[model samples]
Target: MGFMSGEELVVTLAPVAVYWVYAGIYEALLQHTTVLDRYRLHSRRDEETKNIASRKDVVRGVLLQQAIQVAISVAVLKLEGRGAAAAAGDGRAAQPEPFLVAAARFGVAMLVLDAWQYFMHRLMHSVPCMYRRFHSWHHRVAAPYAYAAQYGHPVDGVLTETLSGAAAYVASGMTPRAAAAFFAFATVKGVDDHCGVAAPWNPIQAAFRNNAAYHDVHHQRGGGRRNFSQPFFVVWDRLLGTHAPYALRQRDGGGLEVRAFKPDPTR
Candidate 1:
């Protein structure tokens, strides 16, 4: 009933923690060394010079966004009666849901999140004022790195991330533990999408079609108006004819690069 504790605290903080740890590794390996250079989608030089914002600014922005996310998550837990339920001590042992049921719920949550983000992300690009004032901040990192994944205006983060995540959590009816896992997975996926690596051997990238290469296209100059889906499926972009096809080409400078093809006019 008071400040978040136990499961509630874990649920609210796990995703933020995962984001930092995962992004930190990418920062160290990609930004500070050339060990992963061959797997990179953009050259390290491009990441250093092409990105509009400094690493310090990106870190500050992501920290602020994560703070907002944590606050919203705690508020959601309270609204869902999780805090009070924990306080009242429900003495019964909690039974985990069946694996099939949990998987179904996770699928539903992923769809809901993809739908919410796809629509909202496209809308932000469509509106002149919204694009100029809010979403443009995210676009500042033309060649994105892992830590820049959540760098955006605060209001943009709330609408696109916090609200969408909360919607997914509520709609899927997942347990707090399941929600913690889901949120943590989503955090990792987002970081990977911006990681600037198209490592084919990476299971997460191979498993989801919407990987770093796909997202890298969206960040490019000509591809901005397409491939608006994020972190999961590309169903919306495909169905809506906004999907830009791309090929992963080896850069002349010894890394990989995404060469996005123009969307089909007939579609």
Candidate 2:
């Protein structure tokens, strides 16, 4: 039977490890900034702070979810190992992908993965039962923080983050190397969405149109029901008419203009 090669194991562990270490530190730093607080979408900082989970709870929950995802990833690698063993026995061989083709395929894979995430995320919130049992654990943070990005019930993690990734890899037909890069990209995307700062320098909100502010609005009790997509691209939410009203920053008044999400037929 096939087994996970040492390289495959490293590939799986590296991304998760980097996220835990790097994102953790970044979240901690941003949690206490004062000037940045003015940019917060919701001005109920005092109220939300009261609702934030204790440090211990956040750490325990995030680590537990991370462990579950890692175990699931390891099992998948073993299955792939078995498939490799079968191919070898049948005299089939694998070929390395050309660089340009690999890059193009990886891009397509992200689209598939993103669409999958949008569907599952909407389902988790749309179905009352699923929301109560599986997705609720995530929303426990009414005001989400960075570590909260990966902090969810294992079942929710499987359906959204894990499945979205596997489907993306398959749909994209990414070579093993491209797949590794996808993991890194996905990790950063998750971190950026939850990091809370939405620093002016972040290109994701501009390039992808969904960032911490877009997602933070969803963390609100009412807004969560409206904005059901995650990770990248609000196009799914826009097309479905589930998108929530958002704020447009005013240059002079330091005020926000409330804007509603509308369907874009052109999308």
Candidate 3:
């Protein structure tokens, strides 16, 4: 328990709270943008404004999934003999300052976690049984909103958080405070990916679209066997020869409909 007092705990959590609040606002705006006439996404919940009112639905699902994840994380930390209960009354224990050491750890952990996530994400899709059982729910929401990001089955949610959390834990130099920041940042990023504005200039979104369009295109086409990279770079896909040749193909007048990669059963 690095939380020395109620005030200290508030200070530790304040940034994460603010980040999520901003995500909530950004998610609302982005979801609206996604369903706008420009994107040709049909509105499902509005008639007067020709807009969808999916914000509440998406928020409810995300919150529910996150609540369950938090509960499971608490249980896991308790079982591992860590957390406030373990650290309580242990003045000898060294706790990193939340603002400094923890913040740095968060940054490093995110970078490493992003790379780890990229590869593991591809495995989830490559394994057919696992994809059907554990990953299909995520793909079900083809026309996704921000809240739709977390609208997955329980096992899927657990596996997703566990992988990211384990990556954060393994990433060197992480303090508990930094771990909190990583969790907060990861949550926001997940929600934002579903916010669908195609803002190519936005750094994070740009990286995601260029490197990880497999999952996004999967939503559009029900399946795609290309562009399976994630997070920061498409190096893995490029090396594997599975990278979607979107840019080259587009220049040659081909479209982004990923079904082109499908193998012909009749062949």
Q: Please, what is the TM-score per model?
A: 0.95, 0.80, 0.64
Clashes of each: 0, 1, 0
Best-first order by lDDT: 1, 2, 3
Every candidate's CA RMSD:
1.6, 4.3, 6.8
Top candidate by TM-score: 1
CA lDDT for candidate 2: 0.68
Better of 2 and 3 by TM-score: 2
Give the Å error, residue 10, model 1: 1.0
The digit string of per-residue lDDT tens for model 2 on 99-202 reads 78878887788778778988899889889999999988887776656676787778898888887776776677664555677787888888878765555666
Clashing pairs in 2: 2-81
Tell me the tens digit of each residue's lDDT in model 1 across 1-267: 456657888888899899989999988987679888898887767877888889889999999999999998988888987445645765431557789999999999999999999999999999999999999999999998898999999999999999999999999988788889999999999999999888878899999999999999999997779999987999889898999989988889799888999887666
Reference-based lDDT, each prediction: 0.89, 0.68, 0.52
Residue 159, candidate 1: Cα error in Å is 0.5
Off by over 4 Å in 2: 1-3, 31-52, 82-96, 248-267
Candidate 1 vs candidate 2: which has greater TM-score?
Answer: 1
Question: Model 1: residues >4 Å from true position, as ranges?
Answer: 86-93
Candidate 3 residues 1-267, lDDT tens each? 342433224323543464467566755664455433332222333222322334455466556666666555555444443345324644523444557655667667766765666566677788898788877766666655545656765676666555556655555445444455556656666655655434435576655554223345545553446555544456666666655543212212212222335433332
| lDDT: worst 10-residue window of model 1 | 86-95
